[model samples]
Target: MKTSFSSEFAKRYGLYALVTGASEGIGRCFAEELAKAGVNVVLVARREDLLHTLATHLEGTYGVLCPVIGADLASPEQVEDVFQITDQIDVGLIVCNAGFGTAGNFLDGDIDTELNMLSLNCVAVTRMVHHFGLKFKHKGRGGVVLLSSIVATQGVARSAHYAATKAYIQSLGEGLQQEWHGSGVDLLIVAPGPVETGFAKRSNIQLGKSESPDVIARQSLKALGRQKVIRPGVLAKVLSLALSTAPRWLRIKIMSSIMGSMTKQLPQ
Candidate 1:
């Protein structure tokens, strides 16, 4: 959002940044923000028509090239194909933000749905990072960001799978940062408490603690050069710290209660 960062990010990217899940929500914000910053973006999502429409709008308004890459991230072959497409682009940045969550117990939901969530949230992220990260490192310049959740800090009840998947992001990000030390590869993991992106509505979560997805995207971009866990608010930071140091039982109990209440909207 800052003029300096935008200029620099655009310069580094040289008209190429990949934003997954660009159909809507936080992913859409990432694409728009990147375009505003003067970086050409390749939007990836399952919806081809949405991507095409967005591409036209972005190109017409920002004068930045907006390419659409349609693929189901839950599929490894599709994920590989995306990498091949991006392999030649001067992609100095990547926002691997394509992910979804369910609002019910493990067994209460369809088994295939849970597996799809895992593949998209965890496996695709790791694989794409592996693909782009290696290339970025070889080029000696690039930044990668992973979208995580505040719930990752503790065990929550209804969001059993979602919480764990986000936890994996937190751990993976921290670990990769260490492994890539002095490698000129930047990795940032963002954990936001809640966003007003209507993910809650989609999951039937009624809580109003949601922040705007645009705000989250801005904060995430601002935290790019910094190496640390980025949270959007003081409450998010406090919760993360508390969950990290608090007694296991207490943390679990609190998260369980909150998530349990939230999941009341789901099937019984």
Candidate 2:
């Protein structure tokens, strides 16, 4: 994978890649993988300390530049700041991996937290994609990887808003994939199931099984220019296959049940 990435991926996407939420988890793995493949990375996340640490490590290990950008994407102003900074760099790949999920009953969810999640997961992503998508199209060569989730396939009960946000990304990426078919730009949507990230704890959901973050990152990168959508990892593939042929209502029911179990321990 590293050898292929060093040649094919680097040539296709260019020398520099920008990854959001790059302080940890799948985003961090993506940054590491890209750097290892000889691509410079721009790391964006709210944690400046972590970003700096990771940046230093990647730079030292891979001998590639790692620029750290600390800003909360949930804020529209901050998103602009990120754009302005990144605009100065020659980033050929944009990975929108900075998103969070909310679990538990919709009625019991905090309105502010829900809105913030919307801002970060949807509005921020839309703004980033809109800005970079046009830039990439004009450049005639680039890649865009949008992080979605398996729950995006249906209306997850305990995670309704989170699922909706990912659904938006799924639709957007799918549409752009078609629109950019002959435009020299590749758009890939990564809809993975549970992953062993901070997401489960942060979202207040528990999962019995999950894939490693490296699995998600590697698979997504491998599928970037080759496919429009990929449900990475064995668990994600299995879940997608099982639900793909089900009726919409049944899919929803199954997803709802799964989410309910995950969030059942949370406060009502």
Could you tell me which residue pairs clash in candidate 1? 196-211
lDDT of each: 0.84, 0.91
Q: In model 2, state the lDDT of residue 259.
A: 92
Per-residue lDDT tens digits for candidate 1, residues 1-268, read 2356567876554558899999989999989888877788999999989999989988888888888999999999999999888877888889999988877777788878888889999999999999999888988888899999888877778888889999899899999999988887889898987777747776657674667788888888888877567987655767667778778788888887877887776776
Residue 52 lDDT, candidate 1, scale 0-100 = 95
- Among these predictions, the greatest lDDT belongs to 2
Query: Residue 165 in candidate 1 has what lDDT?
Result: 90
lDDT of 1 at 136: 84
Q: Where does the lowest 10-residue lDDT sum fall in candidate 1?
A: 1-10
RMSD to the native, candidate 2? 1.3
